[model samples]
Target chain A: MTQPIIRLEDISKIYGSGNTEVRALLDVNLVVEPGEYCAIMGPSGSGKSTAMNVIGCLDRPTSGRYYLDGVDVAGLSDTELAHVRNRKIGFVFQQFHLLPQLTAMENVMLPMVYAGISYNERRQRAEEALTRVGLANRLSNKPTQLSGGQQQRVAIARAIVNRPVMLLADEPTGALDSQTTQEVMAIFAELNTSGITVVMVTHEPDVARLTRRIVWFRDGQVVHSHLAPSELSQTAVFS
Target chain B: MDMLESVKMAVKTLTANKMRSTLTMLGIIIGNASVITMVGVGQGAQRYASEQFESLGPNVLFIIPGSDDARSNSFDLPRNLTLEDAEAIANQVPSVEAVAAQLQTQQNVTYRNRTANTLVLGTTPEFTTVRSFDVERGRFFTDSDVQRNTRVAALGSELAEKLFGTANPIGEQIRIRNVSFQVIAVMQEKGAFLGNNQDDTVIIPLTTMSNRVTGNTSPYGTEVTVISATARDEASVNAAQFQISNLLRLRHKVTTQDDFVVRTQKDALTIVGNVTGALTLMLAAIAGISLFVGGIGIMNIMLVSVRERTQEIGLRKAIGASRQDILVQFIIEATILAAIGGVVGTAIGIGGVTLIGATTPLKAGVSTTAVILAVGVSGTIGLFFGVFPARQAAKLDPIVALRSA
Candidate 1:
């Protein structure tokens, strides 16, 4: 059996209690198989970002059985969660979260540093990942030296340099122009095509249309799991 | 994550904000520098005092006529000591290398209307050797001169200049109390000691001083004020003292309390050393306060750094940096700042010490222990003060940090 790279079972994340109680996720079940490119789309106050946080291992669900690469990670401690995040999940954020003090090569080698990889191998792999993203000559350039699209490409290279099981992006192209957005999306599509599982969180219908699967959230539940962009207007997604 | 990587990251971060890093390290620099310089100054003072005490003459002992308590209680001490006692000590004490007795008196001397009252010191020929005073011009009085009661005198450098300026003082007739006395020698310049000027005086033979200048006031044979002795070597000082004490006690026929006291240069040196040592300690302690303040400064800067780098910290955590890794990185940054400050401060402190050595009478030496201690203490202060900010950074929630950023 080929185990799914991500499996979320009966997940519930509630904030506060009594009158202040806010249910971010309720009885959610999500399974992302290997090599799948998926997008989680929702309107504001739809708990899509909270779900992304849980799936990225940045926050824990109140009640759930989360299995990443077939291992139950719901009960892991913060340190162990950190280890799982380092070895399994690679995150690309909306702002291109590259450490400003470091160059592109150093930024990409950061995840490998946490993994205790050899320095020379980390440099070699970072070079390969940056070159694959069409940044072969900009290895030593800092984040300010790169354009918005180039910065996102460096973030992508950093995210994939460790060879993680899943490449998780939260609004990966949110800060880029339409042209740079398409450029970043193409890199994600190429990475996903090469057997790297990709899960993106975005509200744009156009961005969601690029993914094979679009999971729509309403309030705290996944209302439409298989919605096509052409039919998104037909359903009351905001309601 | 690892030590090497964390250190590298810390260096990069510090280099990125050069102004902030240097400002954060200023406290440590000032603290260590003051500590080093103050300690050096204290040691220099101690050495200066030690040399001053040592100039009193090595292996020399002074046998005062009366004991300390007796001298303190009575303003007029019993004039029972005599030249016979000094002679007895010189003959009886095997450890005694040389002995000289002094009888001091103030008298007026006239050199062709240039009359001035001056201190007259009557001492034997051995006084030059025992007291370490040298004769510069003519010869000092011999034992035969003392036996013959020669009416001759040696003039101190300042007194010779005062009485016979431009003209040579040798063979000049200087009248003391209207009695003619010929100047035979001019004594070399000996600086002041304990506020008393040694060069503002005249020296004469003991026999001439007792018989001619000052009348014999004591019923005892040839009364003397203080008897000074030199031991054969440094090791023989105590032996000489013990033998002289026994000889004096027996000669004086003392049945109850002793009649004299023996004093050494070592005692005065010890007292001076203790005083200067305490002063040094006080100075060093004051400087150490700056070190404490410096540590607090480090803690303050580190706390600010944690707050300022919240976004970077959050991004690192999201990427995979553990709490321990972030903690190590922040701590390494603080320690590196303090350690660099310590080394720089040491260099400046050594420079300060060199400056003091060149400009002042003090031979200030760089104390190795102080250097080690200052550097070690600064590094420890860095490590100690770094814990709180590092812990705060480590405990920050990645999501909260990211959102806040």
Candidate 2:
């Protein structure tokens, strides 16, 4: 149907050279369509993080073709790639990497700072994003003052502040307790329901079940791909 | 990103660790303060020396016997300058305004019961004009008194008061070297010069001093001590020196090395000025080393900051910051530190100058050039020292940095 939001073909990533070389990824192919919620699940050292990094444009694949929103990003220069990340991909790490010195509102406004938005508009959009994440009254509170779930919410607000094409999250709820994880998952689910595309990597099967589709990786290669039961279709399943 | 925003970010980061930032800036502060203060003091010393030289006279020259080398070597100076030579210079040289022949001897003076050891000066009536002496009461010795060898003397202000207290001593007789002489005039006040008291001496006719008091020791002519001569004006000092030297050479019948030397007030001023100026430059240079150390301190602290903020760098890069952005951010932080230190240090240096002026003879003088140069140098030092650490931060790979963190 429509062009995929992200398309990867024959992707392979090598860590080192000669005897010490480790193949982090091997001939992996994947496609994510618009308004879709996809989860990548694998054990530790299964190349899930490498696949996430590649999808987020934080790292270039050793040999592959990556088309993000219709442009070949694998051949882009460093500056151009940075611009693409700023304009196209939003990142949310498991650590909730918030600058300690900045307040919640300032942290959320950081991405737009590189987007060259006007000061008034940047502040307005940041306030909207914080409010959307249920942090309206906590705008002036620094990251250390916020709880783990609230900090993740702030990180999510920062990720989407630029209105990037897709949100690339790596274990967004990995650091939270069961209740906080549900709270964060609710926010992501709500954001996804509002037509945002989300690509997440998590080993938890329950977390993967919340997404519309799941891709399973083993030994640096994707071994299975299928739609969740609700959206299951025989032609969409891969074995 | 906007420069204003970058500066805001830098300021925020710096304020987060207030004590460390202040300690980092302390080196620059002390370095700038010392440079400014030393230069100010040096300039003040130069001014003081020039004023002292100007106080000697408008355009005066001292014709001392023997060369500078001979005086420093402690060689005995020939008593070659005679009264005839002084008279000849006065009449023969047009550039020579007035000349005073002086013969000085330390002797004890007694006025009734009061006795004080003082210098008895043998001089002519032209002494008042050549030495800038004013006759406050009565008048100086006339030429006729010199011709007749009259036993009359003029009292300096301090000596007049010492011998007579508030009482007038113009007509009183005082015994010098156990010989009685009448005081003809009382001079006005003149303070000390080069640690020697000018108002503590007695002036009398050279003829009386040579013939009656200290008998002529030189067999060649009426021998006198140093001759004090004045040029017609500022422009005539060199001409007067040249003419006087030639006249003395002929009068003494000198061949290879002349037996006399003429020195000008300007010459002495030049020598003193050079010495103080060089000293000031040396002080500034020494203080500059501290500024260099301050620059190194900035580099050291910046390096540590970059290392500590490796994770932050990765976060910023992931948020779409380019290498240039990180570089500019860190560089701006360093520049702000140095600039703030420079300003505060200048203020402290000005305060120090004021304190020095209040506590000492030097006036409160601030060299604007020194202040500007110090600030400029510190800013440049910050930039120069900041490049390495900033580049290190900018060049860090986002994946490696985030993973390390």
Cα lDDT tens digits, model 2, A1-239, are 78799999999999899999999999999999999989999889999999998888889999989999889999987777778888898889889999999999999999898888889999999999999999999999999999999999999999999998899998998898988887787778788878889999998776777778898898899989888654564322221
Off by over 4 Å in 1: A230-239, B55-58, B62-127, B139-185, B189-236, B239-262
Which candidate's lDDT is highest? 1
| The candidate that achieves the highest TM-score relative to the unseen native structure | 2
**Residue B291 displacement (Å), model 1:** 2.5
> In the order shown, what is each candidate's alpha-carbon RMSD?
5.9, 5.2
lDDT of 2 by residue, B91-174 (tens): 998999998888888888889999889989998888888889889999899889988999999988999889899998978899
Q: Which stretches of candidate 2 lie over 4 Å from their true place?
A: A228-239, B55-58, B64-94, B100-128, B133-227, B248-261, B354-359
**Could you tell me which 10 consecutive residues in candidate 1 chain B have the lowest summed lDDT?**
B191-200
- Among these predicted structures, which one has the highest DockQ? 1
Q: What's the C-alpha lDDT at position B54 in model 2?
A: 83
Task: Give the alpha carbon lDDT tens digit for every residue of A36-81 in model 1.
Answer: 8899999988999999989989999999899999999899998888
